[model samples]
Target: MLFNSYTFLVLFLPLTLVVFQLLRRGNQRMAMGWLVAMSLLYYGWWNPDPSKPWTPFYLILICTSCMINFWIGRFLAAHTFTPKGRLILGLGLTANLGVLFYYKYIGLFERTMEALTLGKFSIPDVVLPLGLSFFTFQKIAFLVDAYRGKTSKYNFLDFLLFVTFFPQLIAGPIVHHNEIMPQIQRTVSPSRRSVDLSVGISLFAMGLFKKVVIADNLAMVANPLFGAVAAAGGRDLTMLEAWAAAISYSLQLYFDFSGYSDMAIGAARMFGIKLPVNFHSPYKATSIVDFWRRWHITLSRFLRDYVYFSLGGNRKGPILRYSNLLITMLLGGLWHGAGWTYILWGGMHGLFLCVNHAWFALRKKLSIPALPKPLAIFLTFVVVVAAWVPFRAGAFELAANGSAQEALRATKSILASMFGLNGFEGWPNAAASEVKFSWAMRAMSCVLIVWLMPNSQQVMRRYFPSIGLRGLLAKTSMPGPRRFWQWRPTWQWTVFTVILVMGSIYEFDKVSEFIYFQF
Candidate 1:
């Protein structure tokens, strides 16, 4: 069920919280068992056709990975890694990645081959289970840590809970077993501070509003623009349309994924567990490196430790290290989707990272003044927005709005339809409506977006500027002892919460499934 939905907000969450707290007073094991059961039930609550049961797929995936890793941990703890042991570790990783590849990309591979070979070859169909990418990484990390003898053999129950802890289970900050398994052993109870609950609920309510109100509405505009471009036989778009499509997509993707992360983090907090913050105002980043550091921080950590570091990391010479960085990002991109577009998306970032690193080294050698932080931020944002065009578009050619050859044909159609030059009748061209800027609200809407949205740094500077000499005097100049009222007025919070809830409700019906659900 969607975290933004009323059913989840009013029914599942309230019932589970009450039961968990009440049962916490009794057997802690029973309380946990009850929670695990509820989590499973909530996961499957929306399923109507039993023929395609989701929970079993998840259960089988989690159970197999956990059991195998638990054994691997025990084996490693008792024995050292010989050549044979290393081979076994390799096989384990392959099995994990193999499952991911088959389900996620085998179809795309087959389709591409068929297109290349004139339909001579195709792979059999396979169903990708929900959370395949996420859970697979969780298992790979578990097994690798085990092989390195980092963790002990955990009990099956605790291990299972770590894998399927409903909050971050699907789209994750990808919680580590090291962080969460210990939390399970702790006393699970409501925090003594009412503020904790209030903060959690408030954050969750904000996320719900972001998803239901803003992101979903934005998608209505974004979806059509890209689809129209593809339908027009991949033609060069005017700069206005190109930027509109690209920026709309960038906003849609950011709010959608980050909104899901916030809800996940907030939901876990209701149970007194703090998931890592996945987004730290990524749009504020001044470089591609900075962007990765802020966005999906946990996944960045995973790739660095498991993939980049495993490939000899910076321990190798400069050339090899750069190669490792590129390879890691390329694979990282492929992890997002089954298509070649995703591969290119990953490769582009890898290329950017490589260039970014080289530029840093050159700058250090020449002792160049750092780009003005504001200018760097602007450039980084532009680069990222350009990258999103590829990520959002159907194919590489589609991203460039078709090649020059295809643009010629598209131009003919555009001219034919525009002035009735080719006797083409009925069904006006989409390009026609697009040219009439006065008829479209898209331009005004774009301006609204730029004005309303500020990066986290901007927000911080505006509301909580530094205690510099000028600022310290400003605070000291207050007539009376400053009250909390000056900073955080109760009426403001109440009004904000009311508006958040109202926005969430108004768009309640369009609580589109979390974008990360596909992963």
Candidate 2:
């Protein structure tokens, strides 16, 4: 269920939180049992209708994969150097990855073949399971770590909890074995600080607000731009509309995905389990390499350890290391989806990173500043935003919409419509002011929210009160009150949460799935 949905916010969350907290009063094991049961229910809730609950079959497939790897982890931990251990690990990886390939990529492979062979062949349909790629990678990483003696054998329950922890389960920061397993063992109760509850709820509300009020509104502009291009049949976009569409989509993706991440992190925190922060202010990055460090950080770590290192990483010569980097990122893109576009996306990033590294090396060698840091930051933002057009668009043609060719035609049509020079005439008197006024008010409210609210990182540090950049900023800025942002934490959070909930409800009709869920 979506965190922003009424049922999740009003029904599932409150009930689960009460029951889980009550169980935690006894012991960590009891609390974990409650959590496991609740998490399963949450995962399976949509699939229980008996008509089309095939989604849970996917969950079952994942659970089975986890169980197999959990056992493999145990066995490999005990016999790391033996041939049997190598065989077990290799076979486990093959089975897991083979399943992933069959489900996720076979259709694409078949389509490519059919295109090449003039529809002479067709591939059988495979149901891609929810979060299969994520869970599969996590489990494989576990086995590899065990084989390399980086982690100990974990009990089935702990392993299961790590795999299916509902907060990061659907779309993840992709929790690691080393980062979360110990925390699961030592369950802690959330303190009944009015401040804590207020902060948690507020962060969740802020996330909902971001998704509904900001991203959804932007999608109106973004979707139409792509749609218009598609309608025109492979049209080029004008510079203004291209940049506008690109910027809108880039911001939409940030707020939408990061907003969901905040809700997940906030909900987990209400139960006193601190999830690692997933996003920094990545838009503020000055370079491509810096951007990766700040964006999808857990995935970066996973790719570095599992994919990059597995390909000999930097251990061989520099040329081999560069080859490994390119290959790893190419695979990483494919991991995002079963499409050539995703492959291109990943390849572009890999190429960008290599060039970035080379440029940095040259800068160090010559001791020259090619551009000011601020200019570099601006250019980086533009490049990243442009890259997102492909990432957000359904197809390549969609990304090329609103070009100069289209804009020229659009201008002719618009002028013809305006002057009654074509089939169009006078404006309709039926266009009501109330509808427009309501929309204007709503738009203003969203703008006010963006101006007043802090980003996800800031919200996280506020609730948990951490010591990173967020914490440091809060510490230094706490005593002052800006014109509109002046309020005590308790009142500020309570009021903000209420408004966010109300805004989400108002925009419920346009509610969309979390963007990252597709990945």
Best by TM-score: 2
- Which ten residues in a row are the worst by lDDT in model 1? 460-469
Prediction-by-prediction clash tally: 0, 7
Candidate 2's C-alpha runs over 4 A off are: 47-56, 189-199, 232-234, 394-454, 462-489
Q: Candidate 1, residues 1-519: lDDT per residue as tens digits? A: 777777888898999878876787777777677778876676546443558654465555556776776676566555546676677778888888888888887776666677678776646666666677887788788777777777765777777777777887778878777877776777743443244355556666667776787778677766665656556455444445555556677777777886787677667766666666676667777889989987787889899999999899889788998999899998887787665666667888999998999899999999987999888987897788767765665342323233323322433333333334545343235655433443234532643443346422222222221112133235344334544433232567668877888878988776678777766
Candidate 1 deviant stretches above 4 angstroms: 45-58, 80-85, 116-119, 188-195, 232-235, 394-431, 434-495
Could you tell me the TM-score of candidate 1? 0.82
Candidate 2: residue 23 Cα off by (Å): 0.8
Q: What TM-score do all the candidates reach, one by one?
A: 0.82, 0.83
Q: Name the candidate that leads on lDDT.
A: 2
User: Tens-digit lDDT track for model 2 on 109-143?
Assistant: 77667667877665665666666777778888888
